[model samples]
Target: MGIITGVIGHWGWEVEDYLLDVWEAHRTPIILATSSILICVWLYLYFSEEREGLVALPRQYTVETKRTSPFQLSNPLPTTKPKVVGEKATTVGPKRIRGEIPRQTTQKESPKRDGLEIQVLVFYSSLTGKTEKAVKDLVEVSQEEINGAGTGTCRFPDAQILDLSEIDYDEYFINPPKREDGKAVDYFYLLLLPSYNIDTINDTFLEHLKETHNDFRIDSAPLSNLVGYSVFGFGDREGWPTEEDGYGFQAKEVDRWMAKLTGRKRAFPLGLGDLKMDGKARLLEWSSGLIDVLRMFAQTGVLGDGVRGSGDADESDGEYASDEEEDTETSIEGNEKPTKNKGSIDDVEDLGKMVAPSEKAPLAIDFTTYGKSKPVNIQTPQAKEMVPKTSPTYAALTKQGYSIIGSHSGVKICRWTKSALRGRGSCYKYSFYGINSHQCMESTPSLSCSNKCVFCWRHGTNPVGTIWRWQVDPPDLIFSGIKEAHYKKIKMMRGVPGVRAERFQEAMRIRHCALSLVGEPIFYPHINEFVGMLHAERISTFLVCNAQHPDQLAALKPITQLYVSIDAADKESLRRIDRPLHRDFWERFQRCLEILREKRFKQRTVFRLTLVKGFNIDEAVKGYADLVDKALPCFVEIKGVTYCGTSTSSSAGLTMANVPFYAEIQEFVEALNHELNSRGLEYGIAAEHAHSCCALLASARFKKNGKWHTRIDYDRFFDLWEERGPDGDWTPEDYMGEETPEWATWGNGGFDPRDTRVDRKGRKIEV
Candidate 1:
C-alpha cells in the first residue's frame, strides 16, 4: 500500500513491498515509464537528508555575491578629525574685500556626533587596570589624525565597556528593554580573560554565563551568537597544558563560538599574549591592536547616523573646542548591572567614594580590587615590610576574584580561595577540599630540604639557591594574579561546558597551594619574617623544607606544620632521588632529624617519604621509619611519588605496574608496626591521593617503665637541647649520638629497627 502511494508520488512512510496489480497490468509507453521512474528517484532523495542530519546548506540566491570577509580592502578607515587635532577655527567672510556682504550670511551647523562609530561593548578583567590601560593606550593611537582642511569637529563615540563582574548577561545581552523578557542589545566588545586556567574554555565561564542567563540555551542560535561574538584570554605557559596556552587556543574559542554563528570557518584563531610580568611596553602594543579592531564599523557611520537625528548638526559634529569645554561635564558613563535606578550614582569611582557617607539600599560593589597580584617569599625577613590587610595588596586581592587560602584575611601566600576551581578540582554540588579547608599560619618558620619530589603538585618551585634575587613587587601585582586565578578557571569551565560534580569546589580548596612552580622556597633568608607576617594574620604555617638547609631550620620558632622531604634511606639512593646540591647529603638530612629532636619546638612535625616504585621506596621507608623514630615527629606520611614537573627521572610513580609496588609497601609498613610496638611507637596504613593519604601522629610522651612516663615535656626537651647563638645559629646543648637514652632500648635486648642502624653496635639514637 505504501509503495502504491510512492508510485502516485505520496510521502512520509516507508514500504518494503512493491505495488503490483494495476501498475504491472497496464504496462506504459516510453514517456509515461520515464516519468514514473523520475517520481520514484525524487522520493528517495527527499528522505536522505532528513535521515542524515539537520545541517543546513547555504541558500541558492544572493549568498555568493556577498563579501567574503567582514572587513574589505576598500572600506574607509574610521575618521576622528578636528577634535583629535584639538583645532579651533572661525569662518572668515567669503568676499573679504567687500567686507559688509559677508556679515549677512550665516554658517552651516555641524552634526552632534560627526565621526563616531558603532557602539562597542568591552567586557574586561583587570589587575590595577593593566589590561584596561592596554585598551586605553590602544584607543589613543588608533584615533584618527586630522588635517587643517577638515570642516568642523569629528568625534570618537564613547565606547561602552563592561566588566563581567558587574553585569547580568540575561538583563543586558539576552533580553533588551522591550523584551521585558526578550531581544538583548548586541554589543560586540565582549573579551573574557586575564589569568590562569587548566584550559582556555573553562567551566566557571560557562557556569557564570549559564547562571547569569538561566533561560538561554548554550546550543541555541541567537544566544550563542551574542555570547560568542568576540573573545580573548590572558594566561601563561607555566602550568599544565590547556587549550588556552597562548593565542592559538584563545583564538579557537573565538573560532568555535563563531562557528555556531556563521556555519563557516573562522579566520582568526585566538591570539596568545604572555607577560612574564614584564614592563608596560608589551601591554601598550597589544592594546593598540585590539582598539584597531573595534574601530571597524566606526567609520561605517553607525554613530554618525545616530548623530544625524540631533537638530544641531554643528553640535552633533563634536568640535575639539567643545570637547575641552565639556571634558568635565559630558563624560558619558554606563551601568554594567541592570539596576532600575539609572542616575542615582554617576560612575564606579563615585560608587566607591560614597563609602564615607555609606550609600544605602543600592550600592555598587567593587570586584576590581580583588584582581591584584602579590609575590610571597621566605627571604627578606623584615616584619614591617610585609603587606598588611589594609595594605593595597590585601585590598586588591580581596576585591577581585582572589581569596587568601587560610582563615585570616591578611595572609599573602598565593592569594587563593575555595572558588579557584569551579570544575576540575572542585565538584560544585559538594564542598570538599576547596577554599575554606585551606589552612596556613604566621610564625617564625623553620625547616629546609632538597628534592623537588615527583609526587609534589605545588603551583611553583622555589628551585633552591638564594633569597633576595629580585626586589619585592608592589602589593597589587602579586595579589591581582592570585585573585584572577579563580575567575579564569570559572571562564574556562564555562567554555568547555560540562564538569564533574563537586570538581569545582575541590579545585577551589587547593587555590593557594601551587606546590610546584620554580625554586626551592627554603632559601629565603627572611623565611622566619615571612612566616611571622602570616602568623600576624592569624594563619598557621606549614613549612615544608628540604633537609639540605638544616642550619636554616635550626634558626627559628615553631610553625604550624613542618615537613622534611626524605626521598631515600641512605646516602647513595638519596642522591639519585633527591638530586641534592650538597656534598654530604645524608649528614645534612641527619642534622634535620637532629633539629626535629629539639625540645622547645611545639609545632607538629612530619617526615614525608616520597615512595617511588624502584628508586628509593625500600631504603627510604625503613630509613624514614628510623628518621620518624629519631626525629620524634608528630606524623609520618609514606606516600607514592607523583610524577610531574621537569624530571625525566622515571615515571615509576605513575605507571600502572606500581599499583602492586605501593600495596607491597603498605604491607611492609603494617608489618613494621610490630617493630614500632616493641619500642612503644605506632604506625598506620598508606594512601594515594590527598584524601586517600592517611597518617600516624606520634604521642607527646613515651613509656619507659612497665607503667609509663606520663609527662616528658616535649617542648622543654627540645628547648634545652637546641641552644641559639647571638648570630642566630643553633648549637645542641646535650644532644649526643654516643649516649643512648633509656627509651632507645625496649624490654627486649634489641633496639627499635627504625632508630638503630645496622652499623651501630646497640647505639647512636632514640627520639
Candidate 2:
C-alpha cells in the first residue's frame, strides 16, 4: 500500500492534497452546475408529459435507417417545403400529432351520425334462409321508405348485415373490439335469431354474442358506451310447443340478454315474423315502425318511450326508460292474444310509440296477403328432395304451410277432419272412443318419433330419434297454440255450405286433443304436464305411444285415454312393421305393455291394432291374445290401415290390396276375442264402425249386468283427476262404471253415405 501511494505521489505530486484543495476552492460552482442540470430535466418532463393522458417521449428522437430484408428498395426523398429560419421540421411515420384532437374521440361527437348518415347493424343466424331473408327484406323496405320520405335530417339509411356464424366467438368473448379512433359509434341494431328447434338456441348466430356478454357479465352498471337494440324472431309458432315458449323463445332470450348487457332501452318493440305466414309483410311492417322510432329519437334526442343521456357512461340525465311494453302472444294461425291493454300494430304508426291503450280486436288475416302479387321477395330454400318430418326441410314447412302447435307439435287438417267438416264422416276414433271429430285437435307433443313406422303416412320426412332431440315447450303456450290452430281450421270451414255455425263454434272450444298426429307423442319430455294442462281446460287427451319409450310411458300421468300402438304380435313382425331405432325394441315393447297394464286402472287403456292384413295376420290370433293378456287394456281398437296416397316411405309401395276390408278387420277382432276367451279372459266384440273398417273389442269387466261402459265419461274423469290432483293415487274405479252414451257407441252412430260428399267420383249426393 505504501509503494502504491509513493507511485501515485510521483505521478500527481500529492494527489490527495490537490483534491482537498480543489473541493474547497470550487465547491459553490460544482453545486450550481448539478442544480441547473436537475432543473432542466424537470422542466422538459413537465412540459412534454403533464397535459394529456397519452404516453410521452424525450425531445431528441432516435432514427434507425437500416433494412433487414434483402429486397428493401432505396428511394429518393420527396422535395421538402421551404422552412422559415428556426421553424421545426415534422418527423412523419406512425407518430401522433403534437397538440391536435380528433373529432370522434367521444360518443357525443361522432361525425358520421352527426352528418345524418345513420347506419344500423343487423346480425342473424338461420339454418334455413327464412330468417336471413326476413332481415334483408326489412333493410330493403326501410331504405325505400327513407328515400321516398326525403326527410333530410335522418336521410341516409345504411344497414350493415352480418351473419353471427362469421364472428370470432373466442376473441370477442375475452375482449370486445373497439373502434380504432376511440369513439363510441352510435347506431341502431337488429337481431333476427331463430331457435334451431322448438326448445334450443343452437343454430342462432347470436350465440357468440351471448358467450362474449356472459364472459364479461357486469351487475352494477351497463356495458361501456353501448346503444339500444331491437330484436326480431323468425320462427313458426306451430314448430314450438305452447308449454315451451314457442318459436319466440330464442328471440326473447336474446333481447333479454342484450338489455341486461347494455342497460339501454329497446329502440322498438320485438318484431316477430312468422316462419309459416307472410314474413315479408311482417318484416315490412316492423321496418316501417322502426323508421318512425328512429325519427322520434333523432328529432327529440329521445325515444317515444323515454330519453337516454348523451354521455358515454350509463348514468342518464333524464328519467330511466319506462318498461311499458305490452305482453302479446302470436300463434301460427296469425292469432295474436294480447295479455294486456296495449296498442295494436296500427297504433304504432299513428302514435309513433309502441305502447298505447287500444280496444281494437285482432283483425282476420286475408289469404291474399300471402299471394305472389306482392313484389317483395321472401326467400325460402327449396329442398332438392322430399324432406322428412325430422329434416330441416320439414321444419321449414312449419314456417311455410303446416300449422305448428308449439315448438314440437304440429296440427294439419287430417283427411278425417276434412271429411267431418264437409259433413261426410268422422274419424274412426270418434266411433271407437266418442271423440268429436270436428272438435278434435289432432297434434303430437313431439315431431321426432323413436320408431319410423313402415306404414307412416308422413313418408319419414319428420325427424326421428331414440331420445328427445328438442327442448320441451311450456305447457301453457302449447295448449293455447293448439286451440288457436284447431279453431283456425274450423274458422276456414265457416264458408263451407252445410257447416253449422253452432258446430263450428263448438269445434272452436276443442273438446278432444288427439296426440296421434304423425310423430310419437310420448317423446315430449313434458307429456304429463301437457296432459294435465289439457284436462284443466276440460279437454280430453288421448295420447298414443309407439311403445318404444317405456320409461316415458311409465312416468305418464293419467289422461282421458291412453292408446298403445300394437303394430305386430311378434318381434320379427314388429321389426318389419315398425322400423324402431332401439336395439332392444322387443324388450321396450314388452315393458311398455307392462306399464299400460299397471296404468289401466287409473286411465282408460286401449291397444290400437293397425291391421295391415298381408303383414302380420298369418297366425296372429294367439300372438295378439298374449299381447292383450300382458296389457289387459279395457278395450282394443282393431283398425284397418287406410291407404293415403303413398310417397317415399315403405308404405308408399302399398296398394288398395294392402288396406284390409271391413270384414277382414271384423274377422281379426273375432279371432282375437276367441283367443282371449279360450284363455279364460272375457274379451268380446262390442261395436263396429263399417265406414272406417274398424271394430272395438271391450273387456267383459266393462259390461256390468249386460250394460256396457266402454266409452269414457271425460267430464267425470276430469273431476276425479282434479279432485286427486297430480300426486293422486286414484284408480279408474273412482270415475268408471258410467254407461256408454248411445250416440257415441260405434253401431249407434256410423258414417251416413246420404250426405253429399267428395269421393272418388267427385261430388256424390246420396238419397
Candidate 3:
C-alpha cells in the first residue's frame, strides 16, 4: 500500500503542475465568458417575467362583464354582513366577490321591426294658453283627416298631444322615443309655439334642442330618425310686425334648431300667424297643408320630389333666380338679344339698343319745363307705374294689411284707429291735438319716398327715388279711392270682437286725415290739391314730410298742422339713420328747417324727433336743441322708434335693443326741455302719451293762463280755411282750442278715462 501511495502522490504532483500552467493561460477568457452568460440569463428572466406579470394583472384585477344599460340603476344592494350590538355577526345571504358582481342583465325590448305605422307627436308651448287651445284644435282636425284616409299598409294612429312644458326632453328630444307598448312606429313631430318677450318654457325647450345639436359626445343629428317635423308660431303684428322684429321669434328658433336635429328635415316652411288678425285662418291653412303632407308621406313613404322637407336647398333660390332673369330681360331693349361676350360690333349694337326707347309706349313728358324752359316733345323712355299691380312691392304692401288704391295711393286702418273702435284707446294725437282716432283716416298719396329710414314700417318695400319719375295719378281719384278703401276696411272691423257699436257707426265718417301712414306724403306732386280736397270736405289734414324735400315743403299749401321729421342731429347721423339717396340731403334738410322757421307763424309747424336708442339718443340733446333753434317750431314731438322687425332693419344693425323704452323717451324729453329752456326757447312739456311712448313739448305761444291750449278747434280751422282760403292771413292762435285735458298733461298718463285699459287678451286691466 505504501508503494502505490508513493507512486500516486508523485503522479498527482506532476498533474497539478501541468494543470496550474493551463489555468493561468485560460482563466481570463473563461471568467469573461461566464460573466457574459450570467448577464444574458438575467436580462431574459427580467423581461419575460415583466411580460408575464402584465399579462396576468388584468385577469387578477378585472372580471369580464356585459355593458350596463343606460337606463339601468347604477347602485347595487350591499352584500357584506352587518354586526349587531350584543349579537353574533353572520354572513348576510351570499357574499359577493370584489369586482366580480354579476351584472343584472336588463333585456330592453328592441324597437319593433314593423315599419307600417306612423305615430305623430304634437308638441306645443303656451304662455297665455292660446297656443295650447290651438294645438288641441289642430290635433282634432288632423285626427279627423287621418281617419278619413282609408286604411292601408302604412296606418296613422291617433296623434298624441304633448305639452312641451310637461314632457321629459330626454325621452323624446335626445332621440326619438320608443313606444312603451313595443309597437313599431315612425314619428312625425309638430310644434305650435307662441312667442313672448318674457321668459317661458319655450325658452328652456329651445335651449335643450340647441345644446343637444351641439353636444360632442352624442350624435349631432340624434333626432334624424324622426319621420318629419313642422312648427307654427302665433304673434301680435301690431306689436311685433315681422320676424326680424321678434314676431314669432321663438317659433323661428325652434324651427331652426329642429332643422339641425332632424338632419334638415323641415316638413313644412315655418308658418307664422298674427294672433290678433289672422291667427285662425293662418293656422287652418297650415294645418290643412300639414295634413296633406302627412297623407302623401303615408302613401309613398317620401316627402315627394321638389318638396322642401326632402332637402336643404334655400327657399329663396327660385325667387332669386326669377329676379336675376327679370333683371337680365329688362336690361335688353325690345327684341334685341344678349351676347355672352361684347367683343363683336354686333354685341356693341345690342348694348346700345338697351338705351333706346320702345315704339309701343308713349314718350315721357318733361313737366319741370312747364315754367322755365319751353315744352319739348322729347322721345324719352316711357315711365313705369310707381307701383304696378303685379309688382312684388305691391304684393308685400297688400300682405301687410294695406289696401293699395289706384297706382300710387294706399289706405290702411291704423292700430290706433282699431283701438278706438274697440273702445280700448286712441292715438297720441287724440290726447295732444283733440283728434278723434275713430274718425281719422290714415292714407298716403305717394307710395314712393326719397329716403329709406331704418325704422320704416314698410319693410323697405316702398319705392325710393330722388325725384318723381313715374305716372302721376290725379288728386281727385286718389281722394275718392282712398276714402272708399278706408271705409271698406272700417266696415270689415264692424264684425270684430270688442268693436263698440256707436264707435263703429262714427268711424264711417272720416273727419281727420293723417298723411303719415307711410312714405313721404309730400312726395306726391298734387299734395296741395289733395289737401284742398280734404279741407273742402271739412276734413282736417295733418301733413308729414321728410326734411329731404325743401322745394316741395316751400310749395306746400296751408294745412291743419305741418310736421317735418328731424331724424338725426347732424349729417353723418342723418346718413346712417335716413340712408337718403340724394347726396345733398343735408342741404335740403337745412333749407326745409329755414322754410319751417318762416312758416311757424302762418302754420302750426312742428318737428317730429324719432329717437332710436343706439343711433340718435345719446349725446344728441345739444344737437336736437340746435335743430330746434334752427326750426323755431310750435311744437317738438319726441317719441321712441318703433321696431319694424324686417330683414332690412336687421341688416342695418337695428334691433329691439335699438328701440328706446318709454322711460328713455321720458328722459330724452326732459333733457330736451332743459336744453330748450337753457337756449331761451319758451318750450314746456305740454302732454305725454305713455302708452305710445310719446311726449309733446310746445311753444309758450300755445300755453295761456297756466294751461295748455295745444288742442286745435277743427271746426274753427275749417271755417277759417273756407273764409280766407289756403293763403289766409289768419294765424294759428286764431284757431287754438280749449285747454288740454288734465289726463294728457306732463305728469298724467294720457290714457282717456272713458276707455278701459286692457291686456293683450282683451281682459280689463285694473288701474
Candidate 4:
C-alpha cells in the first residue's frame, strides 16, 4: 500500500510540473489568438481572389495539375506573329493554365509581323433591321473597347462586319489563311442571328454554317478543330414556357450546337435580346459583356472569366424611356377624349355627320331599271393604242414554214397546192368542191386560233386568242395581198422543171379561197362580211372553223362550203385531243354542232375529222357515227395524221406511234363506214385519196339517184352567191349537183399518197 501511494504521488508531481512549465510561457493566449485570426484572414482573401477569376468550364472536364498548351492559354507577352499570305498559323505546343507563365522566346521579328493587329469578325442576319442596327451599335461601342491605348495588351485594333447573307462561304472558312510559321490561326467570330419565327434558328446563318463546315455536328460529337465563336439571337416574346413556345430559344440552340461542335473552350454563353422591348439597350449590354470575353481570350488565350453579372453600367438609351412615357400619355388622352365625346352635347349634335356614308356615287343612274343594256364604262383611252405585233407571230409562223400576208393573214403553199401548180394534182377539197387546188388561194382573215389540236398540221405555232383584238385588214386588201404573196411563191418555183408556166399563170387567177390556212377562220369578227366580199369577187369560199366559237359560226353567211374540224369523237377524247382553251369545251362543241345542224341545209356542211392513230382511232368509230347522226352532214372527211415534228404547243409528245399507217387508216374508215351504214345514215365511202391518207364519206342526201353529187358547181355557186349578195338566201341544194369531173374526184382527182415522188404538179415522176 505504501509503494502504490509513492507511485501515485510521483505521477501527480510530474503532471503539476508540466502544467507549471506551460503557465510560465509569456503571452501564450495572446499569441495563439493572434495566430488563429491571421490564418482566417489569409484564407478569406485567397478564396475571394479565387472566386473573382473563376470560370464555368464545360461539364466534360475539370481543371487538373498539368500545364496547358500554348493555344489554350496566352502568356503575358507574345512576339507578334506575321501573317504569311498563304501559310498557316501555329497552334498550341503545350496545354497549360493561364497562370502558368510560359518560357519566353527570343527571335527576330519578321517584317510581315509589323503593324499586324488581331482581327474580330462580326456577322449578322436581320429581317426587320433591328438586329442590323444593333450590330452597328455593337461595332461602334466595341471599337472603343477592343482598340485604343487603354485596352492594354489584349486589344483587337481591327474588326470587320459583314451581313451573314452576303459572305462567300469558301473564302472565309474553306480557304482560311495561315501565319508564316505554317500554322492555322483562327479569328474570333461574333454572330448576331435574328430568328425568323421566335423559336426557329436563323435560316440564313444556319445555312451559312452548314455550307462552311462539312462535318460539324450540332447534337453529339467528338469536338475537334474548335474555332472560337460566340452567338446571340434577336427574337420576340409571343409565347413562353411551353414545349414549343419560347423567346430566344434559337439563341440557346445555337449556343448548345456550337458547344457540341467546338467545345466550351471556343463557345461562349448565349446572349439574348427581346426585340419586343428595349432591344437596342439589351444588345449594347450583351456587347459590353462580350467585349470582356474577347479581352480575356486575347490576353490569356483561355476562356477564364465567366458570364458577366448585371453589375455593369446600363447603357440603355434614354430616348427610349422618354418615348415610352410619351406613348403612355397619348393613350390616356385618347381614352379621355372618347369619354368626353360620349357625354358632350356638341358631339350629339354632330352624330348625324358621324354616321357612315352611303357607297353610291353622286349623280349615279341605273339604265338597267328601264330594261336597257348597261352603258359601257368609257375609261380614258390608253395613251398609246396597243397595236399587237404581227412580227413575233409572223416569225413563229415563218419558222414553221408559213408565208405571211398582209398584217393578220398568212399563206402556205400546201404540198397539194404546189403539186397542182406543177400539174401533178390538187387537194381532196378540190375534188369535193370542183375547185382547182393551184387556183385555191389558201388565206385567213385571222391567224390566231384558240383550239390546240393534237394533230394540228401547223405544228401549233399558230397564235391563239379568244377574241379579234388585232388590227384587221379589209377584205379587199387581204384578197390582193394573198394574190401577191401566192404569186411571189409561185415565181420562186419558176426554175423548177415541172412547174408549168401555163399552170402557174392560171394559179395567179385565184378562183377559190380556202380560209383553212392555219387558224379558226370563223373566229374573225368580220367573217360574214369577208365571205360576202369573197363571193363578190366571184371566188368560191370554203371556210374551216374549229367549232369552238358557236355564235360566230351561227351568224356566218352562206359560202360554197363551211367545214367544222372534228378532232375527237367523245368528250374525254375531245379534251385530250383538242386541249381547248374553253373549260366548257365539250358543251361548246355540242353547241357548235347544233349550229351546224341548223345551217346544214343552208351550206354544204362538212365534218373534217383529222384522225390521229392510237389516240381517237380505236372504238371511236361508234363515237364518230353518233356525231354523224347528230348533224347528218352532206359529207364526212376522215384524214390520217401527217406527223409534224415536235410542236411548240404541247402535242402529247406525238411520235410515229401517234401516226396511223395507210392500212390502219383504211381499216378505221371501213369500220366507220359500217357503223354509219348500221345506223341507217346511208353514209358510204365516196372516195379515198391514197397518197393523202384521207377518205371521203358522202351522206345519202348528196347521192342523187345513187350517183354522188359531191362536187360544187363553181360558176352556178358564184352566180347564186352574187345574186343574193351578203343578205341573200341560199342553200347547199342550190348548187349541189354538178357531176364531179373525173380529174376532180377523189380516186382520180388529187395527187396520190403512194406517189409521193411526184413533181411540183403532183404528177408521178418516172425515174
Which prediction has the highest TM-score against the true structure?
3
Tens-place lDDT per residue, model 4, 639-676, is: 88776444332336667677888788778888888988
> Quick one: best lDDT, which candidate?
3
Q: Candidate 4: lDDT over CA atoms?
A: 0.58
Which regions of candidate 1 deviate over 4 angstroms?
1-220, 225-518, 599-601, 619-621, 645-647, 650-662, 682-767
Rank candidates, lDDT, best first: 3, 2, 4, 1
TM-score for each candidate, following the candidate numbering: 0.38, 0.48, 0.53, 0.48
In order, what lDDT does every prediction score?
Answer: 0.37, 0.59, 0.73, 0.58
Clashes of 1: 110
Model 3 stretches astray by more than 4 angstroms = 1-381
Tens-digit lDDT track of model 2 for 1-767:
99998897787866777887999999999899999999999998865653443223334422333211111112113132222223333333442211211111012222233434345678787767777787777677677654443244444356678777776644332223454786434445677787655333343434654654555333212332333466766667676643134656677666655554444345554555566775566666656656655665455443322212221111111222323321111122222221222342211011112212352223222122111223222123431122234544343444333576555777755556655654566766665556767788777767666676766755444556564434456777877787776655554443232332234445656788888876788876677888888888888888888897777788887787789999999999998878777777888899889999888877788998998867877679889999999889988988888654343333335556778877677677777888899998987777667767777889877877776676666777787778878558876656564666554454553444323334432344342
- TM-score computed on alpha carbons, candidate 3: 0.53
lDDT of 3 by residue, 156-215 (tens): 878899988899999999878887897656788988888988888988998999899778
Kindly list the per-residue Cα lDDT of model 1 for residues 244-317, writing each as its tens digit: 23432443343344333322111112333445543244444334333433332233311111011110111101
* lDDT of model 4, residue 338: 11
- What ranges in model 4 sit over 4 Å off? 1-391, 399-401, 457-459, 647-651, 726-729, 741-767
How far residue 92's Cα lies from its native spot in candidate 1, in Å, is 45
Question: How many residue pairs of model 2 clash at the backbone?
Answer: 27
What are the RMSDs of all candidates, in order? 27.0, 26.3, 20.9, 31.4
Report the candidate with higher lDDT, 1 versus 3. 3
